[model samples]
Target chain A: MRGVVLHGPGDVRVEDRADPRIVQPTDAIIRVTAACVCGSDLWPYRGVDKSDEPAPMGHEYVGVVEQVGDQVKTIKAGDFVVGSFFASDNTCEICQAGYQSRCVHAELIGAIGTQAQYARIPLADGTLVATPGPPDAGLVPSLLTASDVLGTGWFGAVAAEAGPGKTVAVVGDGAVGLLGVLAARQLGAERIVVFSRHADRQELATEFGATDILTERGDQGVTQLKELTGGLGAHSVIEAVGTQQSMMQAIRSTRPGGHVGYVGVAHGVALPGEELFFSGVHLHGGPAPVRRFLPELIGLIWDRTIDPGKVFDLELPLEEAAEGYRAMDERRAIKTLLRP
Target chain B: MRGVVLHGPGDVRVEDRADPRIVQPTDAIIRVTAACVCGSDLWPYRGVDKSDEPAPMGHEYVGVVEQVGDQVKTIKAGDFVVGSFFASDNTCEICQAGYQSRCVHAELIGAIGTQAQYARIPLADGTLVATPGPPDAGLVPSLLTASDVLGTGWFGAVAAEAGPGKTVAVVGDGAVGLLGVLAARQLGAERIVVFSRHADRQELATEFGATDILTERGDQGVTQLKELTGGLGAHSVIEAVGTQQSMMQAIRSTRPGGHVGYVGVAHGVALPGEELFFSGVHLHGGPAPVRRFLPELIGLIWDRTIDPGKVFDLELPLEEAAEGYRAMDERRAIKTLLRP
Candidate 1:
């Protein structure tokens, strides 16, 4: 099987790798149908997140189960399934509480490398969410997003409590941010504001139900959001960018008693306790429990209720994953999809 | 009129002050019947919170309305009332959203010195809550607590989502933390754990319905809490200490999907963004919107359902406010009530 691997900073390669096998009775081998590069993947590529050795790439995917371990009763061969970046036993106390990402027994799916022809998923019964049947070919990209970004955006909306009459502001113009705007709209938000400097991303944001778009960042962006919301700031803020500036902007752009849902992969960010304490806002986020929303999101995608696949602009064969990384790193594509 | 003034660190003097008079049409002058030294006062007295000029002390009080400006419609002469430290108009959008402390026209009652014989409360109609009648003489202390600590504790419980079957843990054992135990109990928490080193404070916490008392501090304290909750941590954590250690403990002691209500006046704490982001815990707090919970809390006090006054272990005449401050600063007294 050909898989993506990172050798060093600004270095990625797609090379032939040994095929994965079911190592545990709770494991299932899946034939990768589609995978994608994530914004988080850029962290290591940019030399921001430290990496000690060569590591596998990609955590998001939707594929068909090719083989199941003897004890894997819920999932079987030929079943199309989507799994989150964090593989969790959905029946654990943590998962039952809707925090599968923090499950007591959890593993990063990226560690197993899904950007390959085959991948091994552990705890199959809890990690995989099967569709009613084989999904339409057109739904592949959307279903793949449900494995991570789309599900993550949905978590952001829920964490921010975006609902009827809420003025929600989204910070970041990535796939997750645009999808957050879409999620807020689907959740009944009355007004959605997205901050974007790029025309292409701004257009997608507007189409995804952003009522207002501002071409500003940081303090100026917060000022614009506050001014637009009658000087009180938005009722809910979604932070998709992991930078300190984006995090602070999200907090400052929310009204007192409002909520800030931050889903960015934080790096080198230290929140001053005084400001957060005086902000009088609720904060909740992390690696989202994408497994929790997979079923609903997959249903929505199958029914054509949402077009999450719009986030994927550039596509290439699985072997061209190196080019996919370069395209996203060079800003030529908002996101890149790979077909196995 | 007379008031307590902080001449310098640990230097408090009861001095004669000019009488307060209504300067705004929305103001009301109140003759204080009971006032108390707060845990927050120790900040300045201990020099942790710097003060250059002599500043008036005390913001917690229940008093009788002595006079009202022309526009002060709801409160009048002789009406017994309680007002939070933060005065708000309650009619603003922020107030309507239940964040009266952040109201557009909010003012701190401490600015006018509620510990004085007379206080001019701004936005009287919105800031002061009248009792059913004159509160029973024995209810004065409890009513005063409602002006700050008790109300703050209630906000902590509410914000932490303390309710049936939830395990609630309190991080501080001060007047506010002790009252947080009571608030959690009142809010239907199944179990309440309080971290305390002092026997007297522990007794008060248990009397306030603490189901478990742990003397360990920091990591050990968090470990005990996690061990008690089947290694999953509590569902609701009340962080009433603003120190970094306590804040981190509160966050660490809460299970994934749990909530943290922090009302401690944060001093020099800086929360690492990475830890918070990965904690998977919801954080909400600030100077609590005590004004929002005043009516309901006052009602409970009036009905004898709660005895928050039990927290005031030392009572002194207004002239000995210096001694009162000394008692709290030295930890000789849990709380001290000053009569004016």
Candidate 2:
């Protein structure tokens, strides 16, 4: 099987690797139809998150099930499905409470590297949701996003309590942020504001239901968000960037008693306890329980109710996996899709 | 008039000061019937929170309305009332959203020194909640607790979503933390766990409905809490201590998808964002919006449903204000009641 591997910082390669086998009775092997580079992947690519050895690359994918372990009752071979980046038993207390990403017996699918011709999925019945049938080729990218980004963005919106009568502000212009704007709109938010400095991203954000766009960052962006909401700040804020500045901005741009839902993979951010305490905002977010929302999101995608696939601006063949990483890292692509 | 003043760290004195008068058209002057030393007072008394001048001390009080400015509508002279430490014009959006402490025109009543013979309360109509009538002398301490500690603890419980079938854990054994246990019980929590090192405080916590008592402090405390909750952690955690250890303990003790409500006045706490993010817990708290819960708390106190006054283990005349401070500072008293 051909798969993507990271040899070191900024060193991505597509090479032949041994095929994955069913290691557990709850596992299933899937022939990946498509895979994509994610914002989190850039963490190690930029050497911000270190690795001791060569590590497998992607976590998001859309694929057709090729084989299933004996104990995997709900999933079977030849079924087209999407699974969360984290494989959870879904029946654990945490997963039942809607925190599958933190399930007691969770596994990061990234370790299996979905950016390959075939991948093994654990907790098959709990992690993967099969579509009604094979999705249209045109809907593959959108279905792929439901594996992570779309579900993550939706979780951010829900955590922020974005709904009718809410003025939601999103901080970040990445695929997750843009999709968060769409999620907020779909959740019935009265107004959506997104902070973006790029023309292309801003336009996409606007199209995804952002009623207001600020080309500023940090304090200035918070000021504008507050000004737009009558000096009270937005009712909900979605922080899709994990930088210290972005976290603080998200916290500051929310009105007292509002909520902040942050989904960005935090690095060196240290929140000032005093400011957070005084902010009087509810803070809730982490690795999203993407598994929890997979079914509904797949339904939405199947019916063409949302167009999250538009986030993938660059597409490449599996052999050009390095180019896919380069484009996303250099901001040339909002997200990149690679056909396997 | 006489008032308690902090000349510097460890230097508390009872001194002659000018009596408070109505300063705003919406203000009311009150003859303080009872004032109590608070855990927050120890911050400055211990020199952890520095000040440039001999600041008047005290914010929690139950009093009789002495006079009202022309525009003061809800409160009248001769009426007995209990008000929050932060005066807010409750009509503002933030206040209406139940975050009166962060109202656009908030005024910290502590600045006017409720520990004095007379204190001026701004936003009288919004901040002061009148009792059914003048209460018996025995109820004074309890009503005073409502002005701060009781209301703060209740807010913590409410913010943590303490209710039926929920396992609630309280971190901190101060008056507020003890009251939080009471609040959780009243809110129908299935089980209550309190972390306390002192025998006296632990006994009080048990009386306040604590079902489990852990004398451990930091990591050990969290471990015991997890062990008690089947290793999943408590469903709701009330954090009433603002130090780094207590904050981290509170966060670590809550299960993923659980809630942490913190109300202690933060001093020098900085939350590690990455840890908080991956913790997958909902965090909501700050200077509690005591005014929002004042009416309910006062009613409970009046009906004898809760005896928060028991927390005031020491009583001192106005002239012995320094001794009252010393007793609370040295942990000789859980709280001290001062009569002017």
Candidate 3:
């Protein structure tokens, strides 16, 4: 089987690998129908995160189950499904509390590596949510999004308490941040603000119901947000970029007693406790428990209530995986979908 | 009028001062019935927070309104009231949102120096909540507690989301921390764990309904809490000390998706964003908006539903304010109440 592998920094390649098989009773083998390069993948590609040996790449996927182990009861062969980046045993106490990312026996599906022809997923019954049927070709990218980004954006909005009469500000213009604007609108936020400097992304943000677009960054961005919010700052701030500057902007843009839902994976940042304390804002975010919102997101995708698939501006065949990674890394594509 | 003044570290003295008069249309003059030294006072007393000159000390007080400006409508002369350490116009967006500490026009009473016999309170109509009537002498301490410590502890419990079926861990054994235990119990927490090493404070914590008392500090304290909570950590953790160790312990002791309500004034602590992001916990705290809880807390005190006054282990006349400060500094008393 052929799969995406990274030999070193900026060294993505499609290489032949041994086919995956169900090795545990709780595992299921899925034939990857669609996969994508995530924003997080740039860390290693840009040499920010070092890798010693060749590593498997993708985590987001929508696929058809090709095989199942003896203990997998809910998922079966030939079933169409969408699974989260992390595999969680839904029966665990943490998962039952709606925090699947912290499940007692959770496993990172990317380590198993979903950017391949066939992949074995652990805790199949809990990790994979079966779709109604084989989705149309047009519905592929949106369902693939539910596997991670869309579900994460929805969770971020919910965590920030973005709902009716609330003004929400999103701190990043990546695919996840764009989807956050959509989620905030769908959640009934009265005003949506997206911080974007790019003309193309700004148009998409407007289409997602963003009422305001600020071209500024950092402190200036906060100042603009306050100016638009009657000088009190937004009721909710979504932090989709995990950097010191972005985090500070998100925190500062939120009004006192307001919520900041941050889903960005923090690379290397430290928050001063004194500033956070004096800010008097509620802070709640982490590795989003995407599993908690997958069911609803899948429904929305099926009913055509949202079209998050617009984020996939570039597509490539599995054999041309390297180009897909290059395009996303160069900002030539918002998201790149790969057809297996 | 006489007031407590700190000439420098270890230089607390009661000195004659000019009587306070309403300085603003929204101000009210109060004759302080009771004032106390707070844990925060030790900051400047120990010279951690420098003061260039002899500064007035004390922020917690319960008093009788002696005069009111034309704009003061809700309160009047002769009314007994308990006010927060910070004055806030309750109708502001931030105050209405329950973060009066961050109110746009908030005034720090202590910074303005409130230990004087006669103190001027700004935003009087919004900051002071009057009791039903003149209360029995025994209610003085409890009402004074409500002015700051008890209200702060209650806010911590509410911010941490302590409630029925949840396990709560309190990370400081000071007056506010002990009161947090009482607040957790009143809020219906099933299991309350308090980390305390002092024998007297531990006993008081137990009396306040701490089902488990861990004498360990830092990581060990978190381990003890987790051991008692079936290895999953507490559902709610209240951080009453603003040090890095206490903050880390509070964060580590809370389960994923749990809440940490920290009300301790952060001295010099930095929170690593990566760890917090992976912890998947909700964090909220600050100088508590005590005014928001004043009415209910007053009712609880008047009806004897709670007895937070037990926190004051020593009492002295206004003339001996120096001894009151010394007693608290020497750890001979949890709290000291000075009567005028």
Candidate 4:
């Protein structure tokens, strides 16, 4: 089987590898139907996250179960499914509390590589959500998103307490942020504001239910957001970029007693404690409990309530995974979907 | 009238001043029965928060209403009442959401000097909670505490979601943290842990229902808390110290999905964005919405269901307030009660 591998910075390849087989009773072998390059994947590829060894790529996937181990009961062979970046034994105490990413016996599915023709998924019963049926070919990209990006965006909105009468503001215009606009809209937010500078991204944001768009960053962006919300700031602010500037802007964009739901993978960022304390905003985020929202996300995509796949601007065959990575790295595509 | 005033660091005076009277249509005149030197007062007294000009001191008070304005209906003359540090209109959208401290028309009553013999309380109807009658002499101190410390502690417990078999940890051993133990107990927590090094405070903490007392500070304190909670950390952690170390300790002492309710008036603290993001803890706090809890707290104290006055270890006449401030600043007293 062929799978994507990163040898070094700027070096990606689709190489032949051993076909995956269930090595544990709790594992199942899945035939990958769709996969995508993630913004997080860029961290390693750009050498920002130093790594010397060859690393397996991809953590997002929509696949069909080809074989199941003896212990797999809920998921069966030939079932269409969507699973998260991290595999959790959904029965654990942490998973029960809806923080499956931190489940006691969790495993990063990215370690095993989902961008392959065949891959072994551990804790199959807990990680995979079976669909009503094989989804229409047109829905593949959206279903694939439920595995990570869309689920992450959904988690951000929920964490921010976005719902009826809420003025929700979104930071970052990436795939996740754009989808956050959609999530906030679906949650019945009275108004949705998105921050972005690119015309392309802004268009996608507006299409995703944004009621207002600001092409500003940092303090100016916060000022514009405050101006839009009658100077009280938004009732809920979604932060999808993990930088000091983005984080501060997100906090400043929220009103007192409001919520800042941040899904950005923070890097080298330090928040002024005094400011955050005085801001009076509730802060909640992290490696998003994407698994917690996968089921609902899957249902929405199946019923066509949302088309999160609009985030994908380029599509490629599995063999051209390198081009997919390049396009995303150069900002030529918001996201690239790869078919195996 | 006479009130406690700060001349400078290490300089305090009980000075004569004009008596207060109804100044606004919603104002009420109260004869202060009990006023106390607050930990925050020490900020300006010790020059930690410097001010050159003389400023009236104290914010917590329980007193008898001597007169009411035409608009004051819920509170009448001759009523005994407990009110918070801030006076809130309690009818704005922010107040309706229970963050009365951030009400659009909120005013910090400290500016009027609750430590004075006579105080003109504005927005009396919304800022004050009437007791069933004049509280017994013994309940005076506890009811006075309800005006600030006890109410603040209660807010911390509620924000931490400490209830029903959950393990609650408190970071700080001051009057607020000590009372937080009582709040956790009242909230039905199975275990209450308080961080304290002072033998006297440790004793007070135990009496207030702290099941564990950690003498260590900083990283060691976090380790001890996790060790006591089966290595998963406490389910709810309250931060009563506003410093960066205390905030981080509170966050680290809680489990992945746990809540950290911080009430410390954060000064010069900066939280590492990366660490906080990955911690997966929900953070909520600022100035405690003490006004929101006044009525309930007043009820608990009036019925003798809880005793919060034990936090004050020293008492002095309003004329000797300088001595009270010195005692608290020198660590000879956990809290000081000033009589008028």
Candidate 5:
């Protein structure tokens, strides 16, 4: 089976790899139907994070189960499925508390690589959610999004406590940030503001229910958001950029007693406890428990209630995986989908 | 009127000052019946905080209303009242959201010096909570405790979400931290663990309802707490010390999905964003909205349901304000009450 591997920085290549087989009694062999390059993939691609060897490249996928081990019960062979980036044993105390990312028996699918023809998914019954049937071609990107971004965005909105009559401010314009606007809207937020400088991303933000867009950064961004909310700042803030500046902006953009749901993969950031204490905002975030939201997100996508698939700007055959990585790393595409 | 003033580091003096008069339409002049030195007062007394000149000291007090401004309606002259350290209008949007500490018309009573024989309280109608009648002489200490420490401790417990069947870990041995144990017990917490090494403070903590006492500090304290909670950490952590180490211990001691309510006045602490983000715990704290809990705390005191007055270990006339400061500064007394 051919899969994507990164031997070193700026060295993504397609190579023939051993086909994955069910190992654990709870594992399932998934034949990749579609997968995509995630924003987080750029961490190593840009040389910001080091790679020791030829490591697996992808975690997001919409696949069809080709085989299942003896213990797998909820899913069967030939079932079309969407699974989270992290495989969790959903029955753990942590998973029962809706934090599957912190599940006692959790595994990162990225470690095994999903950008391949076949992959073994551990804890199949807990990690994978099946689609109603063979999904239509148009639903592929949306279902694949349920594997990570959509569920992540939904988690951000929920963490921010965005709901009826609340004003939500989003700090990034990436696919997850854009989808967060949609999630906040669906959660009944009356005012949605997206911080973005790009014209194209701003338009998509507006389309996704951002009531306003601020083309400012840091303090100026906080000022603009506060001015729009009667100088009290937004009631909820979703931080999708994990930089120190973005985190501070998100914290400052929220009013006292507000909530900040930050889902960005943190990089080189430290939050000042004094500032947060004075801000009087409730803060909670981490690698989102996407598995917790997968069922709902998959239901919403299958019913065509939300169009998260719009985030994908480029699509190609699995053989052209390098181009997909290049396009995203160079910011030429918001996301890329690869058909196997 | 005689007041407590800090001329310089270790230079507390009892000096005659001008009698306070109503300065705002919502202000009231109070004849202080009792006042006390706070843990935060030690900051400047020990020279950790700079003071260019003699500065007014003390913010916690219970007093008799001597005069009321025209706009004051809820409180009147001759009313015995227990007011929060920070006076808030309590009708603003922030106050309505239960964060009266950030009220638009909030005033720090310490600035005006509640340690004086006569003091002016701003936003009197919103700041002062009247007792059913004149408090008994024996209840004076409890009422004074409500003015700051007890209220702050209660806020910490509530912020940490201490409740039935929850395990609560308190991370300070100060008056507020000790009272937090009492508050957690009152709130129905099943297990209360207090981190204290001082024999006196630990004894008081146990008396207040601490089910366990961990004498360790820092990482070791967290390890002990985790070991006590089946290796998952406590369900709620109350941070009563405003230092980086205490804050981190409070954060580390809590399980994922737990809450941390910190009430200590933050001095110079910064939290690492990446660690906090990955910790997966809810964080909320600041200058507590003591006014929001005053009525309940007062009722608890009135009914003899809790005896928070035990925190006061020394009593002195207002004229011996210098000795009171010295006693607290030397750790010779847990707290010193001044009678004016």
Candidate 6:
């Protein structure tokens, strides 16, 4: 099987690798139809996160079940399925409480890498959601996004309590943030404000339901957000960029008693306790329980109620994995979808 | 008139002062009957919060309305009232959303020194909640607690979502934390756990409905809490101590989908964003909006349903305000009440 592997900083390669097998009775092997490079993958590719050894790369995938372990009762071969980054039992107390990402028996499927011709999924019934049937080729990209980015953005919107009567502000213009705008709009937010400097991202954000766009960054961005919301700041703020400046801006861009739903993977961010306390905002976020929202998101995609696939601005073949990583890293693409 | 003043760190004195007079159309002057030394007061008294001048001290007060400005409509002279530290207009959007402490017209009543014979309260109609009538002397202390400590604890419990079937853990055993245990009990928590090292405070916590007591601090306390909660951590955790260790312990003690409501005045605390993000817990707190809970708290106190005054184990006359501060700062008294 061919898979994407990271050898070192600025290095991504597609190489022959041993095929994944069912190691647990609850596992299922799937022939991946589509996989993509995630924003988080850039952490290692850019050397922000050091890797001591060669590491497998993608976590988002759509595939057809090729084999199922004996204990797998709900999932079977020949089914089209989508799964998120983390494999959870989906029945643990935490999972039942809607935090499957932190389930007691959780495993990071990203460690095995979904960017391969075939992948093994554990807790098959809990982690993978099967489509009604084989999805149309045109629906593959949207279905693939339900695996992580779309689910994550949906979770961020829900965590921020975005709904009718809410003025929601998004702090990033990446795929997750753009989708967060879509999620917020779908969730009925009265107004959506996005901070973006790129014209392309701004246009896409507008199409996705952003009513206001600010080119400012940091304190200036927060000021613009507050001005747009009548000096009280937005009622709901989505933080999709994991940086000190972005986090603080998101926090500051919310009104007192508002909510901040942050989904970006944190990197060296230390929140000042005094400012957070005085901000009087509810803070909730983390590795999103993408599994919890997979079923509904799949339905939305199947019904064409949303066009999340538009986030993938570039597409490449599995053998061009290195180019995909470079395009995203250099800001040439919002996201890159690779066919296996 | 006489008031308590902080000359510098470790320097408190009772001295003659000008009697307060209404300065705004919405202000009212009150004859303070009771004032208390709060745990937060110890910060400035112990040099954790520096002072530049002889600042008037005391924010919590139970008093009788001495006079009302012409525009004051809700409160009248001769009325017995209870007010929190911050005087809020109570009609702002923020106040309407149950965050009166951060109201647009909020004024710190402590700046005028409620420990004095007469103090001016801004936003009189919104800040002062009148009792049924002049209460018996025996109920004064309890009523005083409602002004700040009890209301703060109630807010913490509410923020943590303490209710039926929830397991609650309290960090810190000060007046606020002990009352948080009481609040959790009133909210029908299935079990209450409190972290405390002092025997006296521990006994008070148990009396206030702590089902479990762990005389451990920091990580050890968190470990004990998890062990007691079936290794999943408490569903709700109250953080009443504003320190890094206590904040981290509170976050670590809560389950992934749980809530942490912190009320202590934060000092020199920086929350590592990565840890907080991965913790997957909801964090909400800051200066509690005591005014939001005053009406209900006053009713409970009036009915003798809760005896929060027990936290004031030591009492002193107005002339001994310095001693009250000393006793509380040295931990010799859980709380010290002063009669002016």
Second chain TM-score per prediction? 0.99, 0.99, 0.98, 0.98, 0.98, 0.99
Better of 2 and 4 by TM-score: 2
Can you give the DockQ of every candidate in the order shown? 0.89, 0.91, 0.91, 0.79, 0.76, 0.91
Q: Provide the clash count, candidate 2.
A: 0
Instruction: Give each model a TM-score.
Output: 0.99, 0.99, 0.99, 0.95, 0.98, 0.99
> On lDDT, who's better, 1 or 5?
1
Residue-by-residue lDDT tens digits, candidate 4, A103-216:
878899889988888889999998999899988999999999999999989989999999999999999999999999999999999999999898999999989899998989
TM-score quality measure for candidate 2: 0.99
lDDT of 5: 0.92
Q: Across residues B1-340, which tens digit of lDDT does each residue of candidate 1 receive?
A: 8999998999999999999888999999999999999999889999998887999988998899999999988898999999989999999999999999999998988777878898989999999999989877999999999999999999999999999999999999999999999999999999999999999999999999999999999999999998999999999999998999999999999999899999998988988889888899999999989999999999899999999999999999999999999898889999999999
Expressed as tens digits, the lDDT of each residue in A1-340 for candidate 6 is 9999999999898999999988999999999999999999999999999989999989999999999999998999999999978999999999999999999999998998989899999999889999999999999999999889998888889989999999999999999999999999999999999999999999999999999999999999988887787788999999999999999999999989999999999999999999999999999999999999998999999999998999999999999999999999999999999999
For every candidate, what share of the true interface contacts is present?
A: 0.87, 0.95, 0.92, 0.83, 0.71, 0.91
lDDT tens readout by residue for model 3, A186-226: 99999999999999899999998899999999999999989
lDDT of 6 by residue, B169-252 (tens): 999999999999999999999999999999999999999999999988999888888889889999999999999999999999
**C-alpha lDDT (0 to 100) for residue B306 of candidate 4:** 94
CAPRI docking class of candidate 1: high
Clashes of each: 0, 0, 0, 2, 0, 0
Query: Candidate 2 residues A59-110, lDDT tens each?
Result: 9998999999999999999999999999999998999999999999999999
Worst 10 residues of 6 chain A by lDDT: A223-232
User: Any idea how many clashes model 4 has?
Assistant: 2
Candidate 2 at B260: error in angstroms?
A: 0.8
Q: Which ten residues in a row have the lowest lDDT in candidate 5 chain A?
A: A267-276
